[model samples]
Target chain A: MIAFESVGKTYPDGTVAVADFDLEIASHESVVLVGTSGSGKTTLMRMVNRMVDPTQGRVTIDGEDVAATDPVALRRSVGYVMQASGLLPHRTVLDNIATVPVLRGTGKAQAHERAAELMEVVGLEESMASRYPSQLSGGQQQRVGVARALAADPNILLMDEPFGAVDPIVRAELQTELLRLQRELRKTIVFVTHDIDEAFLVGDRVVILKPGGHIAQIGTPEQILAEPADDFVRSFVGADRAERRLHLQQVAGREVVVDASGRAAGVLEQGGTP
Target chain B: MSWVSANLDTIAEQLLAHIAQALPAIVLAFVLALPIAKLANARGWLRGGLTGTAGLLYAIPSLPLFIVLPLMLGTSIRSPVNIVVALTIYGLALMVPSASEALRAVSRETLQAATAQGYAPWARFWRVELPLAGPALVAGLRVVVVSTVSLVTVGGVLGVPSLGMLFIDGFQRNITAEILTGIVLTAALALLLDALVVLGGRLALPWASGRAPRRRTAPRDTGQEAAR
Candidate 1:
């Protein structure tokens, strides 16, 4: 469990990034903080790993204050994925994945063995183990980034717009892969993204933020879609958009689900009527 | 042609002396420049101060430096140490700025990623920052190598023996062939050393040697492509 106790961050130059933000993330839950730029989603997520220390309050993991821990050791214990897929361009894929474990004092051979296994876990080929990051495609490089993040088998994963740089198809593929990995691994995940649809797809609960890290709304995607807390939430989530107005229509003797735009989304199953 | 054949032993001795002076100076300057450049890169004021000093040091003429340095070091006026020391200073003047720029060219994203992945500062420098800066550093080093080799000839004006002796003797005796030999051999030596530096860079930093393949393709079964 991770808890942010009235966490606030004000830069030395007097820019308030997050102001009195409070949230508790339960164990094994995937929470996505979705907001526009300057809303402090990335800043809040970084607070969990001590990347950004709060000026006015504290962040604790599993009832222990993160402030007392060494930042380097705390970072080694958690996984971080970011927008640019920041694999070391000079290191081979295997060596990049082995970075954390080696830093934590694991023997080179053992660390590499774990890295090779993680490559398979993250859907990378064995042949890619020896190739430098520059040789890989954008999607493949993201997979390597994911593998490197998972190298230490961390209990918590912090992903800040990890799929933002890839093409839409590859982004969707990576999203699906994350969902599958979450189902099996069950790590506590704090995901930050500006894409609401991505938040709905990957998060167990979505946090919609206004500027200065103020929460506009927080609920499961269904709850937020059904009853937006205010005008801001409604507009941010596009609850009034044509796409949200989905309905069933008869097409070729089968019931099909269509959006208000008349685009067919999927076929309605026969036996699963509510 | 008879003059060349007769002075073969002298030519060989001078060529060896030229290489001995040039090589050590090239190496020492590079070794010293890295840490100095790293220091200069740390802050704006330090960068300005250090590189500004190096640039001013480079502006002093070689013959004057060769003469002035012996007084400061208490070495003999004609000692080869004066040439080596003077050339090393010249090499540093060229190397420090380029090395600082090379280190700066490494992307911030990569450095932040290393930090997030639990790399200590020293580890990050050796593992990530240095290797990524390899191509640029090699380019800087080639400049140092060529210039160091060429500058060793200036020591001959101080009565030090090197390939430069041929030019001095040729000028006084009116043998144009000896002067031509000095110029040709000096240029050849510079080119030869420059080639070796390039070859060494290619061997050490194989990842930086070729154009990065932009599009993804199916993985190859063999590692031969990477070896290239």
Candidate 2:
């Protein structure tokens, strides 16, 4: 469990990034903080790993204060994934994945064995083990990034717009992969993104933030969609958007679900009454 | 041709002396420049101060440096150490700025990623930063190698007995072949050392070579794998 106790961050230049923010993330829960630029979503996520230390208050993991821990050791024990994949361009995929374990004193051969297994888990071919990050496609590089993050098997995974650089199709594929991975390996995940749809897709609970890291709303996607807390949440989630309003319609004598835009979303299942 | 044949032993001795002086300067300058460059990269004031010092050091003429260095070091004017030390100062003048630029070329994202992955500062420097800076460092080294080799000839003016001695003796005696031999040998030596540096770079950084060709071919292999 990660807890941010009234945390705030003010830069040396006097820019208040996060002001009096508070949140508690339960163990094994994946929470997404979705906001625009300057909303401090990334700042909040980084505080969990001490990448950005709070100017006021504290962040604790599993009832232990993170500030007291050595930042390097704390980072080694946490998994971090970021935009642009962030895999070292000079290292081969296998070596990149094997980095954390080797740092933690695992023998080279043993770490590499674990890395090879992770490559399979992350959908990379055995041949790619020898190739550098630059040789891989964007999607493949992200997979390597994911593999590297999972290499240490850390309890918490911090993903900051991890899919933002890839094309939409590839982004969707990675999102699905993350969902599948989460189902099997139930690590506590703190995801930050500007994309609300992505937040809804990947997060168990979504945190919508306004301009100052202030929570506009916090709820499951269904709850937030059904009852927006205020006007800001409604506009941010696009609850009033035509595409979000869905109804059943008869199409070719079969009941089909259609959005307010009249676009057919799917066919209504026969067993479930609408 | 007769003059060349007569002075073959002398030429061989000078060539060896040339290598002895130039190689150490080339190596020592590079070794010293890396740490200085890293220090300079730390802050704006440090960069300005260090690079300014380098530029001032480079501006001093080689003959003057040779004469001045002997006085400072208490070495004999004709000692090869004076020549080596002088040329090393010259090499550092050229190398420091180039090394600074080379280190700067490593992306911030790569460094941050290494840190976030839990690499200690020293470990990150060795494992990530240094290797990524390799190609640029090699490029800087090639310049240092050629300049160092050519600069060793200047020591002959101080009676340091290098390839430059041929030019001095030939000039006084009016022997065109001896002068020609000196120029030819010096240029050839520079080229040889430059080639060696290039070869060493290729060997050390295998991933840097033929990047465009690799990029074109790699996708096909992966595409085939994807089809399976």
Candidate 3:
């Protein structure tokens, strides 16, 4: 479990990124923080890992306050994935995945073996194992980045716009992969993205952050779509959110493309919602 | 033609003796440069001072340095120290920048990834940082070997038993063939040293073939892994 109790950040220059944020993300839940550029969602997430120290209040991971923990140790147990896939260009896909494990006292042979397994888990071809990040396409590199994050088996994964760099098609594929991985790993993932659709799709809990580190609304996707907190939340999700809701209702189930006139288009039954 | 045929044993004796002297200085320089380069990467002022010292050493004519060292240390002219000092001067000069640049050229993305992986600071420098920067470092060492060979030949100015002494003796005797022999052997030796450096780099740094990473891995993760 992760909790931010009245956390705030006031930079040395007097700029306030987050102000009095109070949030709790339960274990085994994928919570995505979404907002405009300066809404402090990224700052808030970084605080949990102690990447950025909070000026006031405390961020607790499990039961201990992060401020009291060593930053390196804190970060070691937390998997972080940044956009651009942040894969080490000098390392092969397998080595990149083995990086953290090797650091954490795993021997070279064991670490590499685990990395190979992670590559499989992340849906990468074994042939790509020897390739560098530059040698892989954008999507493949991003997948390797994800695999590297999962290498050490951290209980908490912090992803900052992990899929923002990919094309829509590849983005969808990654999102699906993430969902499957989440189901299997059940990690306490704190994801940050600006796309409301991505937030709705990937988040078990979605946070709409207003400017100045204020949370406009925090709830599940269904709750937020059905009942927006205010105009800010409603606008961020867009007017098409209601229509988009229909898409979610059919998720992971089946594809039943029908004509506009409520008639089945292709191999539809004569009576099955045609 | 009779002189060439009759002096073959003498030529072999001189060549072997000269090589024995030159090889030690070159080998010492190669070993010394690796650690100095590693040190230079961490301390800017030390690097500058050390590099500046190397340049200063190079500026002193090999003849003078060889003579001066014996005078200052009260060591005999025939001691290996004089020759070693001259060769090491060139070695450091050549190795300083090559090693430093290799260390500096280490990519930030690689460092970042290593940090994220939980490597402690020093560990990164040793395991991920040094190993990844291997090719450039070895290339730098290659330059060192060549420079050492060249400078150790110069060490003969102090009466050291070196290839330079062979060349100098040939000059003294006006034996053009003997002089040509030293030059040819020295050049071949330089090339052989270079080839060895390249081979060492490839074997030592198999992972260095990939392009540099855009980011540096964190120092923390690097230290942890290196320490392990």
Candidate 4:
């Protein structure tokens, strides 16, 4: 479980990034913080790993204040992914994945064995283990990043726009892979992104932040779609999109709901709520 | 050409002596520049000051430096040590900025990634930063090698037994052939040194060979390409 108690961050230049933010995330739940630029979603996510410490109030994981723990140890204990999929270009994919484990004093042989398994888990070819990150495509590099993050098997995973750099097709594939991984692992995840649709798709609960990292709304995707907390959220969630109407339309024979973007969003079973 | 052929053995001996003088300076300068670079990497003011000092050192005329170094080091001007010391100083001055810039060339994202993965600073510097900086460092090394080889010819002013001897002999006795031989040999030596550096870089950074397929496909249209 993670909790933010009156958490706020003000930069040295007197810019208030996050203010009066409060939230609780249950264990095994995937909570996404969604916002545009200046929403401080990245800053908020970074706090969990102590990359950006709060200037006021506190953040706790399972009732232990994160500020009290050694920053390096705290960071290593959490799985982190970023937009760049920051794999070290010099290290081979296998060594990159094995880094955290080796840093924590695991035997090199054992760590390498675990990294090989992680590469398989992240859907990378075993042959790629010896290749450098620079030799891989963007999607492949992102996969290596995921493999590296998961190598340590941390209970808390913090992802900041991990799929933002990929093409839309690749992004969808990675999203589905994350869903599959989540179903199997069930780690507590804090995801950050600017795309509302992504948050709705991947988040168990989405917390929408306004420009200053102040929460505009926090609810499940269905609840937010059914009832937006305010006008800002309505537009943010694209509630005006035809997909939110939830009306059943016959596609050949099966009833499906199509979004305003002309894509099929969901299918409705017979006599089910649209 | 006849002059070079007739005196092939003497030319060979001088070539060996020139290499003996130049190669050691290059090696020593490369070794010394690394620590200076590492120190100046993160601090802007320090890097600027060090680079400025190196620029000043480089601007000093080789003959004057060659003459002055013996006095400073308290060595005989006739001793080969004077030439070695001066050449080493030149190499250090030339390589300092190259080394620092090469170290800086490693991207911020890569460093952040290393930090996020819990790499202590020392480990990150050795295992991540230095390796990524390999290509740029090699490029710097090539420039220094070529420049040093060319500069060794100037040491003839001090009568430091080298390929430079041909220049001194050619000038005093009006032997155009000897001067030509010296110029040609010096140019060849520079090319040889540059090639060695290139080959060393290839060996060090095998992954750099085919690493940028994506960038190649979308090659940024710099104005030169458009103009062509």
Top DockQ model: 2
In candidate 3, which residue ranges exceed 4 Å CA deviation? Answer: A8-20, A35-44, A51-56, A70-73, A89-91, A107-110, A208-217, A221-274, B1-57, B72-74, B210-228
Assess candidate 2 and give its TM-score to the true structure: 0.95
Q: What DockQ number belongs to candidate 3?
A: 0.18
Model 2 ranges off by over 4 Å: A250-254, A270-274, B212-228
For each candidate, the alpha-carbon lDDT, in order, equals 0.90, 0.90, 0.78, 0.85
Looking at model 1, give its docking quality level: acceptable
Q: Give stretches of model 1 more than 4 Å off.
A: A249-256, A270-274, B211-228
Give the poorly placed runs of model 4, Cα more than 4 Å off: A248-267, A270-274, B1-13, B38-41, B173-185, B211-228
| lDDT digits (tens) for residues A1-274 of candidate 3 | 9999999999999999998899999999999999999999888988877778999999998879989988777777899898778776657788888888877778999999999998999888887778666666677777888988888899999998988877777788889999999998999999999999899999999999998789999999989988898988888997444344332123246555444344434432346563
TM-score of 3: 0.78
- Per-residue lDDT tens digits for candidate 1, residues A1-274, read 9999999999999999999898999999999999999999999999988878999899999999999999899999999998878888877889899999999999999999999999999898987888888787777888889988999999999998998887777788889999999999999999999999999999999999999999999999999999999999999999989889899998899999999999988999878965
- What is the lDDT, from 0 to 100, of the residue B23 in candidate 1? 97
For the candidates in turn, chain A alone yields TM-scores of: 0.97, 0.97, 0.89, 0.94
Q: A260 in model 3: Cα distance from truth in Å?
A: 17
How much RMSD separates candidate 3 from the native structure? 7.7
Please give the lDDT score at residue A253 for candidate 3: 60
lDDT of 3 at B225: 24
Best by TM-score: 2
Candidate 4 per-residue lDDT over residues A1-274, each given as its tens digit: 9999999999999999998899999999999999999999999999998889999999999999999998888888899888869988767889989989998999999999999999889888877778777666677777888888888999999998998887776778889999999999999999999999899989999999998789999999989988899999999998886766555578888988776667788787777565
In model 2 chain B, the worst 10-residue window by lDDT is B219-228
Assess each model's interface with DockQ, reporting 2 decimals per model.
0.34, 0.41, 0.18, 0.26
lDDT of 1 by residue, B139-197 (tens): 99999999999899988988899999889889989998899888899999999999999
